[model samples]
Target chain A: MRIKVKFHSLLRLYLGFGEMILELPDRQDITVRELIDELNLRVGKELKNKLLDGDEIKKGTMVLLNGKNILHLKKLDTVVQDGDVVVFFPPGGGG
Target chain B: MKSELSMFQRQIELLGTDCQSKIADTVILVAGIGGLGSVVAESLVRFGVQKIYIVDNGLIDAPDLNRQILYTYKDIGRPKVLVAKERLSSINPSCEIVPMDEKISESFELPNDVDGVADCLDNFADRFTLAELAWNKGIFLVHGGINGFWGQITSIVPNKSPKMKDLFAGVDEERQQVQVIMPTSGIVALLQSLEIVKLICGIEPNLIGKLLLIDLLNYDFDKIEV
Candidate 1:
């Protein structure tokens, strides 16, 4: 399956890239956690820690699927199918 | 362009014709012409607001191109308020577009004629300044903000209503940083415009005394009662 990933704000520094269209292992069903783990491995330990804490992704950062928010979905367990677009963003909060 | 009073025919049928006329006659001021303000202004004009005052000092830039929907590549170096006025005028020439090409500062003098204000500023300092100014002038202010997956929208009538500064109290201006996402910004702006119209129509707004929190990642729309 191919998923489009987007990175925003401070996370962009660690991601070393702004966005990417990548191929994920084809599974009948997948969770956000599973995908995060794979991204963690690809992004390396130091950068991953900046975005994730222990085994969980930080709450401050948001993950949106297509135009819908993942928080409205199942969170980490939000299932993904083919051609899903996932956007990761750490929004500026001062304004 | 016909009255389009018929476009509002359904709402008039529900709220009665008198209140609908009040909305059609109301004049609104939108403070800021960036990501959030631009959308709020456009939405209000689309809903048939009779007059709109757009305030801003910044010029369009590459970064703004991402979320500030009102401007395009040709607008890159132009003042935002002018572009906003041009675009909004094109959208609804029936509504008067008053362009105040200045930053909302502590010494700002709001026009005595406007009915309400929409706070779409990108910083807390300016927001507080505008809030104080509006409060002193007895204007109802609608506030909206978005950062990442979290966003909030609320309306304040100053001393008449629970003050927003009190609810989000003790906020340090220096440490505060705002991160914006396109979707959340657009959604919150729409909600702000809706609240403005409700106020114009003398209808009770949903976020009058509450903060609407939207976490897009989870798609959870939660309200925090103040």
Candidate 2:
């Protein structure tokens, strides 16, 4: 399955890349947590520390699956479909 | 007496009288007088947004001199909204400027006639408060934030877009001291002003239901659908 992941705001800077196309095992579905883990592994960055704390996304960071915030769905356990687009964005907290 | 159209002749010639009237008829509440608010309020005044209500209880600080254009070093320790009202009024004497020396909170009462809001507050807690207040009022809120070389902007319109609180659902309200270069705040605030202008002028703003991210470090700009 091919899943496209995008990074925006601070996450893009933290990950060192704006986008990545992940080719994972041909499973029917995978949770957003697994996708984040695989993405961190691919980038060799502990993105989880900056972006996630256990099942919850860290403060200031949001994980959107196909433009909808995953927190509104199933948090990290939300399933992702093939060809789905996920974005890791940390909205700026300052003015 | 100089006609209002003549004062905005340059812009009216381009956007036409219909757009000009819409801007004059709209009232915007700018919820901050710091970096983003400074530019947004100034821009709105210059754009002929005839009525503006600016709110902030912050006092000018030494650090603010770098980006808070409305206040100078001599104005440190003075209230931001008061200085902002003075500056904005000088720019457009005909424009009505109301200074509210207060912080946005659950108890803070938004002006009854406010038509839109500029979310230029320094922290997310107040941003959420101001956003929801505008939502309850069925008015649009243009949000802008800047840190370092990065910035983001979005517009939340009632019934037309998701709630800002929902979109930033996971955001913790803890305040942090954030760094912002002068230009980053200026750029973001100007865009926030433009978003409000477009919304007031009956033109579609690109930021509604979407986030526009700016990475001035790499000169990259991206818009992500929220």
The prediction achieving the highest TM-score against the true structure is 2
lDDT per residue for candidate 1 within B1-226, as digits (tens), equals 4556656676667877777678777888898888888889999887878789899888998878877888999999999999998998887777789999898888899898878899888766687788888888888998876666566677888665556555444233332445666787788888888888788777774667665656666566655444
Count of backbone collisions in candidate 1: 18
Clashing pairs in 2: none
Residue range B1-226, candidate 2, lDDT tens digits:
2766578999998888898888988999998889999999999988899999999899999999989989988898999888888888888889999999988889998888999999998888888888888999999999998878888899999988889989888876767788888899999999999999888876864688898888888788888787
User: Tens digit of lDDT per residue, candidate 2, span A12-74?
Assistant: 777678888888776777899888787778888888788787767887787888889898999
DockQ score of the complex predicted as candidate 2 = 0.75
DockQ of each: 0.11, 0.75
CA lDDT, every model vs. true structure: 0.73, 0.87
Q: Least accurate stretch of 10 residues (summed lDDT) in model 2 chain B?
A: B1-10
Model 1: iRMSD? 9.2
Q: Could you tally the backbone clashes for each prediction?
A: 18, 0
Segments in model 1 whose C-alpha atoms lie over 4 Å from true places: A1-95, B1-16, B174-177
